[model samples]
Target: MNLEILTPERKLYNGEVYGVQLPGVDGLFEVLEKHAPMVSALKAGKLKVLKDKSMSDTTSYAIQGGFVEVFHNKVTVLVEGAVPAEAGR
Candidate 1:
């Protein structure tokens, strides 16, 4: 699936991912390729994405709060703040 992480400052990630875990406002949910379409409100927590081609390696971001949209085989995350891999998991 296509995934993009966006922050108030900039777009953090834009690529294909095999899986994604979101910190939903109500709870956490996972998304995979061709999964059901949906939109979710987020909580202050982490967003983890395992690159589409690999499962062991992962990328995590500390997000203040955000929303995730899943559609057309793509996922877009809009957040107030986000921390990328270089910043630590």
Candidate 2:
């Protein structure tokens, strides 16, 4: 799956991935390749993305509330606010 994380300022991430774990408004959900089309509201929490190979670990990001759209084998996440996980250090 191709994933993108965007904000009003700029595009945070855009690339291929195995899966993603999103903090949905209601709860958390995982999106894998070939996932059914849908839209979701995000919560203020962590966004975990599994990139690279099958056994690869996920990368975590911190973000505020936002919306997510899935289509055409791609997932786009738009956030009210976001910062790289490392930035929290």
Best by TM-score: 2
lDDT by residue (tens digit), candidate 2, 1-89? 89999999999899999988899989999998899999999999999888955735668899999999999889999998888786332
lDDT of each: 0.87, 0.89
Candidate 2 collision pairs? none
| C-alpha RMSD of each candidate structure in angstroms | 2.0, 2.2
Ten residues in a row with the worst lDDT in model 1? 80-89
Error of 2 at 34 (Å): 0.3
Highest-lDDT candidate? 2
Per-model TM-score on C-alpha atoms? 0.89, 0.89
lDDT of 2: 0.89
Give Cα distance to truth, residue 83, candidate 2, Å: 1.0
Model 2, runs deviating above 4 Å: 53-55, 86-89
- TM-score, candidate number 2: 0.89
